[model samples]
Each structure stands twice: as C-alpha cells, then as structure tokens.
Target: MLTSANLLLWAVLQLALLILLQEAFAWWIIAIYALLLLYSATAVLQKRSAASLKLANIVAALLTLALLLNMRQAGVLHFMLQILLLSAILRLFAMRHRHEARQLVWVQYFLIASCFILHQDMLLALVIMLLFGANCYSHYKLFAPAGARLNFTLTGRAVLIILPLWLGMFLLFPRLPPFWQIPNAKIASTGLSDSLDPGSIEQLVQDDRLAFRAEFSGTLPERQQLYWRSYLYEHFDGRTWQVHPQRRQQAVAPPTTAADVATASYRIIAEANQQRNLFALGMPYSSSQGVKIGSGGLIVADKVVSQRFSYSIESALAPLPLQSEREREMNLQLAAGNPKTSEFAAALRQQHNDTEQFIAALAAFFNQQDFYYSLTPPPLGRDSIDQFLFQTRSGFCGHYASATAVLLRHAGIPARVVGGYLGGDWHPQQGYLAVRQREAHAWVEYYSQGHWQHFDPTAAVAPERILQSLDMSLSDDERDMLIPFWQRSSVLQLLSLQLMHLDYYWSVWVLGFDDRSQQDLWRTLRQHIRLIAYSAVAIVLLLLAGMGLWLLHRRRLSKPLPAKQLLLKALKPALKNKAPAQSVSACLNELAKRYPNHAAMLQQLVQYYELAVYAGQPQAEHSLKRLLQQHKSSLAALNRAIKNT
Candidate 1:
C-alpha cells in the first residue's frame, strides 16, 4: 500500500497545487480541492483501492473542459496552472503500473519547475530541494525489489557526477529574449496619474504605499532638491485638470536643456503602479531600451509597469528649454466659464508689470491670507478656482497648485501643473531613498524669461512639507497609520531591513536576470572565464587518467581466474552429471545419504550456498565460506568417486 509510485505521485501533486492556491479561485473550487486531498489521504492510509474511479475520471475531463471555457476572467498562465493542478491530483488515484508510475515521475519534474516559476521565496526554494531528494529516493524504490531499504547514497552519487556537466552547459548556453510579453496580472498600487483633479492627489498622499527606490551615483541630494516629476497636467476644467490631446500627440523628441548646467546620474527601481508615466529627478534622458522622454520632460515606460521595473537616467536639474508656441497656447487653456477667478487674477496682475513680480505678489497673498493646508478640504461649487482662492483657502497640494496655475494663466503667464513626488525617507546603510505615495505633490511651472521656471505656491504656505517627510507636516492623527514598524522597535527595524537585502539580490540575480541582464553579465563573466577556461578543456585528459586506474582495479579483482578449472572444482559432485538435474538441496540429500555422520554439515553447506549465490545476498557469503571449509573432507571423497566413474 505504501508504494513509492503513489508517494511520489501524491507529493508532486500536493506541492504544485499549493503554489496555485494563492491565485484567485472560486469558493466551490476550493471545496473540490479539499475533497480531492481527502480522497488521496484515504487511499494512502486506509489501503483502499480506487472505486467508481472511471466516473470520477470522466468528471475530471469534463471539469477541464469547463475550466477552459470559463477562464475568460483568468490569465492564460493562471488557467494553465489550474488545469495542470487538476490533472496532477487525478494521477494520484491511478498509479497502479510501472508505465503509469514512470509517466508520473516526468510530471513531477515539471511540477517542481512550475513552483520556481511562480514563487522565489527563500524558504520555498529550499523546500523544493528537499522534495527533490525525496523524489530521487522514490525513483530508486519504484524499480527496486519490494521491501528494499531506501538508498540515498545512489541518488547522491548520481547528482555529484552530473553537477560539472550541468554547470558547463549553463555557463556556455546562448541567451535569447522572449518573442512575446508575458501578461502581468493587475496590481493595486499608488502613484501619479496622467491627469490631476481636485482632491485626487491629496487623497493619494494619505496612503503610505511605497512608490519607488532610488540610488544616486554620488552623495544623495538634499530633501528640498528631490523633485521626481512624472506627469504634466495642462488643460483644466473648473474641477479637474487633464492632459491636452496635443500634449500626448507631441512629436517623440528629447527635451532640450542648456548644456551649461551639470547633470547627475541616478537609477530607480519602481513598483508597479499600472501607469506608464515614469518618475525621475529633474528632466531625465534614458539610454535604457523601450523608454523615451516624451513632451514636458516626462519619461514614459513602453507599457503599464505591472511589476518592479528599473531604469537609469541622467538629469540636468536646471531650467528646461521651452519654445513651442503650440505648447504655450496649450498650457494657457482654461475654462473661460470660471470668470470670477479670472477677474480676481486680473486685479492682482494690475499691481505688477513684470511676470516675476506678479508671481511674487500672488505668493505674498497666499502667505498673508488665512490659508490652512488641510487634508480634508470642503468641496467647491462650479467655480472651483474662485471658491478655493477666495472662500475656502484650505485644501491639499491639488487645491494650491490648481489655483496657482489658474491665477498665472489669467495674468497672461503660461503655466502648467507638474505632478510627482517631493522627498523620501533616506536609508543611510543602503545608500538609497525610498519614496512613498504620501510624498505625492503638485507644483506650477511657468514659461518665463526664455525658459520654464519651477514654482510652488504651496511651498510658500507650508515649507516644512517640502523640506522633510509628510509626517512632519501632518497632524499625529493623519500620520498614525503611516508610521513604519522600525520607528517603534529597534529589533524589528533591523530584522526587516536585513530580510530586504536578501530579497534585493534574489530579485536582481534570479527573477530580474532576463536575456538583457545575461548579455551584460557575459561581459563581466568573460574576464573570469578567461582565467578558468583551461579547467573545462582538461576534463577529457582527466577522464582518460581516471579510466586507466579503473581498468587496473578491475584487472586485480578478476585476475588468475581459469574459468574451466574453477567451475569443475566448485560444481562437480554438488551439481552432478545426472540426466535429470537436481537442486543444490536435492544433490546435498544424495550426498548426505552416502555419509550419514556428516549429513547435518552437508545440508547446512547447501543452504549457505543457496543464500550467498542464488538469493544474491552478499552478507550471507561469510557463512557460506565457513561451511565450505568444514565440508572440504567430505566433498573431496565425493569428488574422487566421481573422477573414478
């Protein structure tokens, strides 16, 4: 009942199915899974044979068909995983023959690989190796005689012998990129969007979800200087700000900046936000494949970032060139229907002729007024800009940036809203910065003095929000949930970060090591390979030398064997020349009759010979040798009689 075939079949089926259990499944499907597991346990523990299994087998096939037809809601990979899971479980009930058991081993190999594909946790990967050893032992037991003890030494030797060949192939194989993109399942994430609306960004900032992590080429920048812009909002209705169609349709050209300013290099690992807008410091230009700088100096990913994505960029961190009249006209667009805010802005402009002076005047007004930077701001009527500027005077970065851009546009200053993160929590040990969603912000960029200049009216109202983390600006109530565990306990903080470091290397070397990473790795590996390249070439010579020793050992073991003389001496009287042959026991009986005093000794020698030679028990050979010594005198007499005859 405890057959190795059944053990392996159930083991692979159970482990592989556990991996897929993390996927979204119907409640009824989970019930069926538990039922199948129960059925397998019954067969193993109770030694019960499969009954009415043909009907169950038919039901399994029908279920597979049903899954194929109803998997429109699931991804292709998810569907395939489910189908394999069902079939793996089904095989547990049917491993009754050698052919079927052999097929099950092949299925187990795929199951192990599938587990690695779906997950890369350190503990789980370690578990797979342990399971692999068990599978190898199962293979030995499946073919060995019944009740044979498990032989781990055989499996261990086989793995060691194949290790060198496996390493050589892996290091020398050519890497090729995938032809099609694997569809990523959707992820719930927090980041900037293509458009900005009243309260959209303010509500987003309340979430403490991590956005991205950045590492710089040199010393980290000051908190005030970290402006990671991702989106530029131009067209604004009374309540919402959106991207002008013309903005998205702009010619795919690099953003031009003055060559005089120094540029800094930094790389970022961004979490999947289901948005194509890329975040970077200053105006970024990328040499990474499939990424390009679009209009308004915004970096754009080739597709929705559905996983942790990485890219490198160099930023000038200076004034960007702005010359297109079309861009000027687009940025100046506003809902003329909101006339009250426009009239108020015109009066503020009357006091200053210079654009810089007018911008300063507006900043002075927000500072002088009783404006409160509140997370929970009151909703406005149709004339949102008018209400927010004159009446409410209290909202998040969105309310401040929107009103500032509206006022600047009404004053004949072309301005647009820039959306991105502001600052991040610095990790000195890792030498990186982790930007969170709470750092989401909006500021105004105006085309002034032959270049677009950055301006933030909200910065004038609350400068601490720009100079430090959002927690510094938020009340204790607003920031309680955002507090990191590390801040509360020293031990937890140290342990969490240590685990993060392990995950970083695992992702970089394993999950993220695609064809492109391989090409880059090859360049570095080529130098080391140059040093050890001779080792592989020496394999043939070493094999020859080892084989010579093996042959010498073989000669010593089988030497001085004259087969005819040995056979005659060993088998002569005991295995007679009779027409009808007798077994060793029967031959011993005939010999015992001739020498009655030695009958017990003769029969004992016969039994020993049967165990050592016929039954293939090497452990019994010692007893056989002693019995042969004791029977030498009797056998000599019988041999002389046979010789005379």
Candidate 2:
C-alpha cells in the first residue's frame, strides 16, 4: 500500500523535473538531490521509527534553508522552487497521517502545473494524460478505506463520462489573448541576433536544438538557392556588426525579383527563443497581425516570441533586386579601421574593370586561398578581417561573411551581411524541413548591376555544409562532440523524425489553436451556431444530472448495514434454540461456548461488532473486515461440531 504512494509521488517529481530542469537547475544540485532521494527511499523501505524520521526531517529542513539563503548563484524563484521540492521530499518520507497525505496531493498538482508552465510541447500534453490517470488512482488509494483495493473499473467509467464535457468546454471557450504579460521564464536566448560579436555565430552552432520547422506549399528550392534572409545588417563598427539604425523607418514594400514570385509559399512553426527575431525562407509576404516585414524583406514581431508561433511566408527564389539611394549608402558605409584590409580591397578593385567582374574575382579569391572552414577558429586581434585574411585564414560563416562585407565596402561597392538560417534537414517522410540552430548562418549580399545578389564565401571553403545538414557536414572530430554539445542518434534518427512529425501537427492543432483559427472555424459553423450552442447546453445539463444520479446510486450500494440487520446476520447460526434476532451478548455466549477452541477470535469479533453497532464507531471499516473474517472461521467450527454430533 505504501509502495504505490511512494512510487507515484517520486514518479510525478521526476517527470516534472525532467521538463523543468532542462534550462534551469545546476548539475551539483541535481547530484545532491539524487543522494537525498536514495536515502529517503531507503528510510521508507526500512520502516524507520517516526521519532527517528522527525529528527532527520529537522536536519534536512535546516540544511535546505541554509543552502537557499546563502546560495548566490540561483535567483529567488529558482531558490523557492528548490525549497518546495526539498520540502516535498521530506514530506514524502515523513507521511504519518491522512492530513499530511492530503497535503501531498496538492503538491502533486503544483508540480504538474510547473511542468506545463515550462514546456508547452505536444509530448508534454500526451504525458500529462497519463499523469492524470495515475493521479486519479493515487488519490483513490490515499483516501479509500484501509485494506480496500482501488477500483480502476469505476475510475475508467468516470473518466469516460467526463471526457466529453472536457472536450466541449475546450472547444467552446473563447480564445483570448493573455490578460497579463507572461514573464520570459528562465530559458537562455537562442539562434541569430541582430548584433554580431566575434564568437556570436560560433555559439549558435554549438546548440543544435530546433529553431523552427518549415512546411512548404509547392516544390522546394535547390540547396544552394535556399537563402533564408532573416534581416539585413547595414552598420559595421570595425569589429561587430549592427542592424541598420533607420531600418524600422525604412519599412516599405521590397522590390520583386524579376517577374517570378515564389511558388513555394511555406508556413513556419517557430519555437519560442526569448527574442523577437523570426525566420522564413526569404522575404515574408504574408504573416499574422502581430508581425511586420522590414525594408530588407525580413520578418519582425511586435513582441518577443514568448511561445510557439506560426506564420505563413511567401518568398521569391531569385535574388532580391534592392535599388535605393538610402540602401546603397547604408550598405556601403565602412568603419575607419583595418588599413591593410582596405589596401587589399583597393588592389582587387584595380585588377577588375567591371563591378560584376570584381565581385566574381573576389568570390573566386576565397576558393583559391588556403582559408579553412572550421568550427573551432583561433581568436583574433584588433583588426579581425586583416588577421583572418593574412594570418589565421580559418573561421566559420560569420568570419568569411563579415570579412567580405568590409572588403567589398572598401572597394567602393555596396555590401552588407545577411544573417539567418541556411540549410534544413528535409525529412521526405514527414514533408517538413527541420531547421536547427546549427543552420544559423551569415553571408554577404553585395549590390551590383541594379540587383542585390547573395554570396556565401563559406560556400567556397565548405560547400558541403551549405549542401548538406550539419551532422553530415562535420569532420570526425566535430562528429564526436559530447561535452556541452548536441548529438543525433543515427540508430533512432528516423524514429525520432516520425515522432516529431506527429508532435508538430499536434502542437499546431492543439497548443497553437488561436483566435484566428477559432474565427475561421466559427465562420464555417455560423449557420448552425444556435443549434450547436443549444445542444452543448443540453448535454451539460444531462451530464450534471447523470453525475448526481451516479453519486446517489453509489451511496445506496455502499451504505453501512443498520444494527438490527448486522446483528441478525451475525447471530443467525447460533440461534437454533433462541429467537431469530438474539441480543449481541446472548449470541456471543452461544458462539464462544460452541467454539471454545476458537474463543479468543470469537471474543474479539463480538467486541468489534458491539463497538460498531451499539457504540457507533464512525471509523469501523477496517475493524469490520477483521470481525467478518474471524466470524466466518467460528461459523466453520460450529458446522464441523454439528456434523460430528
């Protein structure tokens, strides 16, 4: 009996932590918790005295309080969470009464809510269903009469009855925006940023967590043609790249490339990343009301993407023809540093006559050089491009892109770095592209011949990374990454993909169900809205009536037997010479005399029956079962004696 309670509580805590602790708790804290949990389990199994547990609980409480108060590494919220978890552990070990056990039930609800708050994924939703079932059973066992088994059959029937009501309420509830601004809970920022520091792009590659998923409407573009332009960066301050300051002011309809628009309009389901940076294939033509398209044909949100967001996007496959005086000047602007980088650009300009030829020659230069594409590049000095070009000659996409933009500007050409995701693993089986943070890439877009064309210098060095997924584009050394690294299991990769496909649709239909979708649904059912509403109201009324009837039926079935009925059944066997319903003491004497060998058991049963029937002991369920068991044995002895006579 205690085993079920212990396992259920522990399982709830473990599952909650599995979801919450992904971006929260430290390793040492988890290790310490594991040890304490082991000890608590041992104490319960050993059946330690209550007094011993009280002393241990006091020490544990003091230690936990001291740890939280003195710990500077964790925030107040995290500390509160830690304290709550510790108290739960302590309470689990020291459960002594029905009151304390009831307290644990409320705590389980809190843990479930905490997990939901942290993870809004479809997988969590499915797991929550199982958790609900377990909780129902645990609750039944906790408060049920001692020695009585939980009736799962009744529980299942109750769930089946309630499920329809739950579904009705969910469908009928108005989809309203949040009443209060939800806090950006403890997850770190992920993927691309407007500003690019020395190792900013490098940090993104280390985390291969899903950034967003794309599902297209038509045929997909070629690998090289799939240039996902997030937003344009127009300013460079010697080392770092910043977004064009007047970008918001320059919000205008971007020029179309040639006459051909993108046939492959896609919908992107982006994960929340504590930032407003949203992504698409190229230029986003269609989006939700909350989103805005920048002048450079990139998506921008009014608020931080605090949850999973879905937006439709239409992008042209060809190069975007950006033609404007402001864009030309902004993209061409260069910082007053890196004299050697300027000199090299001047030499390249002197070699080529035409602007297009100079760009092509420059693109060729990266391939002709000894530059190496690497994840682990050496640190740079003051002039980053000068060092990368002359000495180190090794860096990722950000390095090559940044250096080329600076070099292009020095040569009197308009160029800027375009930051966004590149290639995604096209899961043919699922028909959705899984784009991870490792696909976070930066490349140069130089304006020439009245058009802005995309050029990835990283492609000249590491073409495979542009052509294939991150995992397939890695060296043996990068493939074996384990410490603070991302990995995909080759054995279960296909299985994982199929599971994610299911989860994605589930999230879209369930978690991503919003006001717009509700309105669309409402439009379809407008003619029958009154009929549906009436039917729903009628169903709810019927359900309430049914539940009231069930309660009354259960009461009738399990109601305790009255004193007269109970006494008559107990005394019937020994009443051969007496009245049909003999008094308790008279029935007891006859039974004890007939079964003298079983006198002790008969006396115990008689005392319990008197306490329950005459004294009216409310908590007599356990005593009743014991009395009935002993009474059956005494009746057996009487029968055996009668047979012998």
Candidate 3:
C-alpha cells in the first residue's frame, strides 16, 4: 500500500500535469489546482485513513461547486468537465494503491473529452488526440500485456487504431435531439428579446452574444437603411411593453395592388433566445420551411428553437397596409388611465386641420427639446409617459418609441411600437453580416395618409443614434469591452474571425441542417456521386501516402549513411552525408601523418554532413551524389595506403 505522503506527492504531480494541459494563464485556475493538489498529496503522505480521504474529497467537491458557480455562463459541458477535474483531484487524495491511481487517470480522460464540447477548433482537437496517445502510453506502461511479451511497436499500433476509432465514434454518433429542454447553463441571454422595458436595452450593452447573422445575395443594405424589424409591441403595460398576446390564427389578405415590390430576400441563421419570436426583416412577403407566419405578421417557429436555427424570408420595402379601418381602430385604442393625454388629443384634433402638420410639430418637440438617447434611462413614475417627457429627458429606444406612440394617440393619430435590431457588422472578407444583442432598438409606426408610416423618434433626439452603433457614441468607460484597434488587428483575432465564419457555415450547413438542407445535400450527392466517390478515394490515398512517408522518416532516424558516401574521405561533401566522426577521429589521425592535408578536408566534410542531416536542415538529393563522386579517388588512395601499411 502506498503511504499517505507518497500518494499526496503523486497527486500533486498529476495535478501540475493537468494545469499545464488546461493552458489556463489565469493565476487563479493554476493556483487553485496547485493548492488542491498539494493538500491532497499531503493528506495521503500523512497516512490519513480512508475517513480522512473521504472528508477531503467532500471538501474538494464543495470547492468544485464554488468554481462551477463562477463558470455558470461557460455552458453545461464546461461546468461538468471542471467538476470532473475536481473529482480527479479528490481521487488523488484517496489513492492507496495502483487501482485508485488508474481511476484518477480515467477521470483525467473524462475531463479531456469534455474539452471538445467547449472548443471544437482543429488545433484543440489535435491536442486532445495527442493526449489520447499519452493516455494510451501511460496505460500500457502501467498494465502490460497479460502472459504475453509486450513490444513498443505493437503497443503503438494498438494505440493508433484505438484513437481514430474513438474519434470516429464521437463524430459519427447521432446525438438524439434532447427530449427535454436543458436548462441554459448561461444565466444571460444569447440574443436580443422581443420584449422591452426600461432596463432591457441597458442590460444588452454588457452581453457579447451574437444575435443574428446575414449573408447578402446582392448589394448589401446601407447601415442607415438596415433596420431589421423583429417584434411588434402593440400592447403596453404603462411600464413595459410586450408583443400583443398570442392571437388566434386568422386568414391574411392576399396582395392586390402591385407597385415597386422588389424583394430583398435573406436567410437568417439565429441562435435560440428560448422565446417564440422568430426575427425577420420588415414586410416579409414569403417564408420557406419551418416558420409559420401569423396573420398579425409575426413570424414564429413551429417549435421553440433551442439550438441554432435557419430560415429564409423575402422582404419588400414597398408599403404593406392599404387602408384597413379595423387595423386603424386597433392602433388607436388608448391605455385605460391616460385622461390628460386623451383630453389633449381632443383639443389638438379640434385645433389642427392637417394631421401631417400636427405629427410634424410633435416630432419637432422631441428634436428641439433637451431629449437625449441613452441606454441607461432613469426610473419612470406611475405615469410613464409623463415622467419620460417632463422629468427624465434621457431614455433608450423603448422610452422614445413609447412616448412617441402615446403622443400620437394624444394627437388623434393611430400609432404603435416596432421592435428590432438596427444594424449589423459587415464582414468584407466573408461577405456576411453579424448582428449582436446591442443592436436591439425600438421605433414607432403611425397610421398616416392611409398607411402605417415608420417614424423613428430616437432620430429626432440623436440622429446618429438611429444610424450608427451605440459603441461609437459611448464614453471610454462604456467602451471597455469593445475590441481595441490593436487587438482587432492581431493575428490571433483575425484567425479567430476566420474560424467563426467557418463555424457559422458549419452551423448553417450541418448543425442547423433541417429537412431542407438534407434534401439539398441529397440532391447534390445524387448529381455527382461518381465524381465525389473518386475524389474521396484520391484524398484517402494521398493521406495514406503522407502517413507512410512520416513512418519512413521515423524509422530512418537511426540508420547509417549510404556506403558510397562513407567512401568519400577528402572532398568536402554535402552536410547530410557526413556521419558522426568522434569514434572515427583516431582512424583519421593515423592517416593525418601520411596525408595531413586530406585529413582536414575529410573532417570538414564530415562536420558539414552532420550539420545538414542531424541539425535538421534540408539536404539536396543531387548534391550528395556529386559529393560521393568527387571524393571517389581520394577514398580509394586512402584504402590502398591503409592496406599497404
């Protein structure tokens, strides 16, 4: 049985190895791992009984839980792996014999496997593959072949086969769609929501989650014009607003009048917000596949999307509503307790003959007054509109939109709130758009001149706020998380962006591959099966050829130079052909007395050969042959001299 102190020492060694594996530069992750390893090792070294080990394990588990809490936003796979690492550390403390030590190693394997779920990059995958080899070697060393002589070659071959098989299983196994929703390990939202309150916009500024991505087919929409409308909030609760409650499906009116209906089609690939709202650009005419567009013009997924989901929609900038009296009545309804605003609307209606002029006056009121667009808006009292307009002039998109809509009602104009993201990051290389949560905005649409007219009141206050990103407008303190110029230009960041594009495409084509994408894949495969098959075969052959070449290199490492090169004694040869001369130095010394000039040349040639071959420099093939031929005469003369002597 291993003594407690020795076991503790072993635990510390294993943990240091693990810390090195994590590549965590964070002193805390390293320090915590080191401290725990030391404590566990010390407990074992002290010969603490099983009870003490168990108690130590319990404390380790608690510490793991605490660390896990810190990584709550890291996702389920990350949290589990961290806990497994802690469990391994705890196991290290308890290891009394070889069996327990092996179990601790298995825990390490589990931790390593979980890393794939967090980072699936090619480099990380390769590192994990190597770690797998290391694991196999450790296992072989510990548990030799039973009753059979173990050889390095056979053991290595077994490991090579096993590792690929394991990787194949991981990649090929169909992960059954989760029957139940896994609790979002991240406490924060991944994308913008349909709902908007006072603090909604402010909170988004702190999050760095990707909201939606757009790949344009033709000329991209200008940043100023790219108002990708998502949700429509018709009903308000004096404080916050929500999309008019799930309404019953009704038949939509088909298009009648056709005028300037140029369609701007887009395929949106969005990460799930766990909300029902499936976002699309304004005036969506037609949609493809899984989405069911409601009569109220709200596009929703047939099922709640928990993973990345993709859908295509065609939108037109052309006007949608053509004078619906029923829709106008719905838009005009005022909330129950706004008597003062209602009275003001009656007076304004009687005073103004022109509705357009009255609307213009209200817009000018917002523009001319000291109203400001701010992410962090002050608390609004019970009379939300009054507090916003009179007391707290600083507000977000919601405040501007809400106050505008309420003012429109007071001026006897039918209006409602439109919620959506404003702009997207234009990737010049990938030619795609990435929309973030911080792009979430709210605007107003009034029923004017027989149609719903989009009017942005935020533009009235801060015109740039409607067009440009808030990051551009924020103070240095607010822009803390904004990627710095140097950081953005870094090689790593560029590489990361490229990888994200690849991942986005992977998600679009593979992860989010629904019935539609499957059909598309099937069609393509059917069209080019023979060519595809031949290409695949060629790729496999090339890979095999490379593998064979690598194996040959590994084997040839210990071999002697060609015999022809060995004969070259005087002429300076290519560096690759020169063999080690320390043992042969004595042989050269005897020849030096008879042919001292040739001895110096032979030594120089040998040195050059050693430097080229052993020092890892490239060797030219023809140069070696030329070297052998040039020294042929000198070598023969030397041989004759030796024989005669």
Clashing pairs in 3: 4-44, 4-45, 5-44, 5-45, 8-41, 345-410, 575-608, 575-609
Under the 3 Å rule for N, CA and C atoms, how many clashes does model 3 have? 8
Candidate 2 residue lDDT tens string, 1-645 = 455455546645544554454454566666666666666666656666333566657858786876666456555545656666666656665666667767766776666566665567777766775665566567777778888886779868987999999886677678777787544444466678779866888788877688898888787778876767776788899899988788757758654544556545887888888677688665455566777765777777777786787877776665666646888888888787789999999999999867888878877889898988777889998898899999999888899999999989999999999998887878776778888887788998888776787788877777787887555556778656522322255546656666788888877788767787777877878978899999999999999999999999999987756643554565454544466577665666666786688677667767766777778885553576656665786666665665565
Query: How would you encode candidate 1's per-residue C-alpha lDDT over 161-248 as one tens digit per residue?
Result: 8998886555556766678866754333457776788889877886766688887888787777798888888988777888777888
Measured on C-alpha atoms, candidate 2 has an lDDT of 0.73
**Alpha-carbon local distance difference test for all models:** 0.73, 0.73, 0.66
Candidates in order: C-alpha RMSD to true structure: 9.3, 12.6, 11.5
Residue 523's lDDT within candidate 3 is 83
> Candidate 3's residue-wise lDDT over 1-645, tens digit each?
444433544464456446544632234666777776776655555655543666776777677767766675556644555566767766765555678767766776766665554444445566766766666555554575544455879768987999899865544455565696544444333455656777776777666667878876777876766777767776666767776653343356653334565567778887767655777665677788788665445577876655567888777765457435666676666676555556655666676758777777767888998987666667877887777777778887778888888878767687888887888788878777988877777888888666677788877777776667767666566566555455556797778678778877676655665555556666887899999999999999999999999999987985555532453433223222335663343444545656775776566555555555556444532454465577777766765665565
Worst 10 residues of 1 by lDDT: 560-569
Q: What's the candidate order when arranged by decreasing TM-score?
A: 2, 1, 3
Q: After superposing candidate 1 on the true structure, give the runs of residues whose Cα lies further than 4 Å from its correct spot.
A: 2-77, 86-172, 179-190, 206-209, 336-340, 378-382, 484-487, 511-517, 524-645
lDDT of 3: 0.66
